[model samples]
Target: MIRLMQHADIHSVFNIEQQVQSHPWSLKQFAEAVDSYQCTVIEQQGQLVGFCILQPVLDEANLLLMAVAPDQQGNGLGYQLLEHSIEQLPNQPVQIFLEVRESNTAAIRLYEKAGFHQIDVRKNYYPNPDGTREHAVIMVKACSDDFAALFSSP
Candidate 1:
C-alpha cells in the first residue's frame, strides 16, 4: 500500500535511505520533506518498505528523492511509488523532472520505463563516499493528454 508519509515514518524511511544511498539525506531532511513536500511511503505486511518525495510547482513536478530497502530491491515497489506520486500531484503537472546518479542504472531504467528521457547532466552533482563527485543525469517526462496512458501498458 502506498500512502502519504507521516511524522512517525521518518525513521523507517531514513533507514531505507541510509541503506540505498551513498550519501543519504539526514533524518532532519526526511522530517522536513514529510512536512513540506508530497511524500509517500509504501508498506508491505504493515512494515514500511519504500518511500518517495515529490515537489510540485505550478505545472511541473520534481521527484526529489526515492528509495527502497536494500532487501526489497528488484521488486516493483519503486515503480509503484513513482507512478502513484505522479498520479497524486495536486494538479497533473505538465512535466516531471528528476535527477539520478549516473551510475544508478536501475533507477534510470525505472524512470525511463515510466516515460522520462534524459534532458541534461550536471557534473559533480553528487558527493561520493570516496571523496569524489558523481554526475547526475537529469531526466524529464512531458505529460500530454495521454500521459496517464503511458503507464497502462503491461
Candidate 2:
C-alpha cells in the first residue's frame, strides 16, 4: 500500500537510498522534502518499498526524486508509484517533468512506458565518484484538463 510519508519514515527511506544509489540524499535533504514537497511512500507489510518526491512550479510539476528498494525492482512498484503521484497532482494544465541518469536504462524505459517523452538533456547533471559528471535525460508528460485518461479503461 502507498501512503503519505511521515517524519518517522526518513530513516528507512535514507537506508533504502543508500542501498539503491551510489550517492544518496542526506537526512537533511529528506527532511526538507518531507517538509516542502508532496512526498509519498509505498509500503508492503509495513516496510517501505518505494517513494517519490514532487514539487509544483507554476503550472508544471517536477519529480525531484524517486526510488524503489533494490529488491523490489522490476515488480511494477515503480510504475504504480509514478501513476499514483501523477494522479495526486492538483487540477491544472500541468506538465510533469523528471530527470533520469543517462545510464539508468531501466528507469528511462519505465518513464517512456508511462507516456513521458524525452524532452531534453542536461549535460553533466549527475555526479560520478571519480570526480567526473554524467548527463541526465529530461523527460516530460503533459496532463490533460482531465487526467482520467491516466486511469480510465484503455
Candidate 3:
C-alpha cells in the first residue's frame, strides 16, 4: 500500500537507505527530512518495502530521495512507488524532477519507463563506494494537462 510516511517508518526507511545507498542519510537526517519534505512509503504485509521523498513547491517538485529494500528491487515496487508519488502531486501544472547516478542503470531505466527525460548532467555529482566519483543524470517529467491525461487514460 502507498501511504504517507510516519515517524515509525523511518527505522525501516533508514535500513533500506544504508543497504542500498552509497552515502546513506543518517537517522536524524531522515527524521528531519520527514519533518520537512513529503515522504511516502510502500508497505506490504506490515513491512515497509520502499519510500520516496520529495520537496514540492507550487507546480513542481524535486524528488530528493527514493529507495527500495535491496532484496526487493526489480519486483515492480520501485515503479509503483514512483507512479504513486506522481499521482499524488498537488493539483496544478505539475512537474517532477530527480537526479540519478549515472551508473545506476536499473534506476535510470525505471525513471525512463515512467516517462522521465534527461535534461542535463551534473559532472561528478555522486561519490562512489570505491573512492571514485560518478555523474548525476538529471531528469524531469512535465505533467501538464495532456501529460496527466496520458497517465489517467485507460
Candidate 4:
C-alpha cells in the first residue's frame, strides 16, 4: 500500500535511508520532510519498504529524496513510489526535476524509464563516506498533457 507518510514512519524510513544511502538524511531532516514536504511511503505486508519526498511549487516540482530498503530494491517499489508521488503533487506540475548521485546508475535508469532526461551535471555535488565527492546528475521531465495517464494503473 502507498500512502502519505506519518510520524510513526520516520524510524522505518530512516532505517532504509541509512541502509541504502552513503550519505543519509538526518532524523531532523526526516522530521522536517514529514512536516513540510509531500512525503509518501510504500508498505508491503505492513512494513514500510520505500518512500519518496517531493516539493511542488506552482507548475514545477522537485523530487527531493527517494529510497527503497536494500532487500526490497530491484522489485519495482522505487518506481511505484516515484510515480505515485509525482501523480499526487499538489499542483499539476508542468516540469519535474531530480538529482541523483552519478554513481547510482540504478536510480538513474529508473528515472530515465520514467521519462526523466539528464539536463546537467553538478560537479562534486555529493560527498562520499570515503571523503571523496561525486557528481550529481540533474534530470528533468516535462509533465506533458498525459502525464498522469502515462503511468500504468495500479
Off by over 4 Å in 1: 146-154
- Scored by lDDT, model 4 comes in at 0.91
Task: Give the least accurate 10-residue stretch of model 4, judged by summed lDDT.
Answer: 145-154
TM-score (all chains, Cα) for each model:
0.92, 0.90, 0.89, 0.92
Cα misplacement distance, residue 66 of candidate 3 (Å):
0.8
TM-score of 1: 0.92
lDDT of 3 by residue, 26-124 (tens): 999889988987899998788899999988876678888999998788899999998898788665436788999998899889999988999999999
List lDDT for all candidates, in order. Answer: 0.91, 0.87, 0.87, 0.91
lDDT of 1 at 85: 86
Give residue 76's lDDT in candidate 3 (0 to 100). 96
Q: Where is the poorest 10-residue window by lDDT in model 1?
A: 145-154
The superposed Cα distance between candidate 4 and the true structure at residue 52, in angstroms, equals: 0.2
Q: List the residue pairs that clash in candidate 3.
A: none
In the range 1-154, model 2's lDDT, one tens digit per residue, is 9888899999999999988888899999999999888899999887898999988777678988889999888999999998888788664435789998999999899889988999899999999989899999999987765465445737
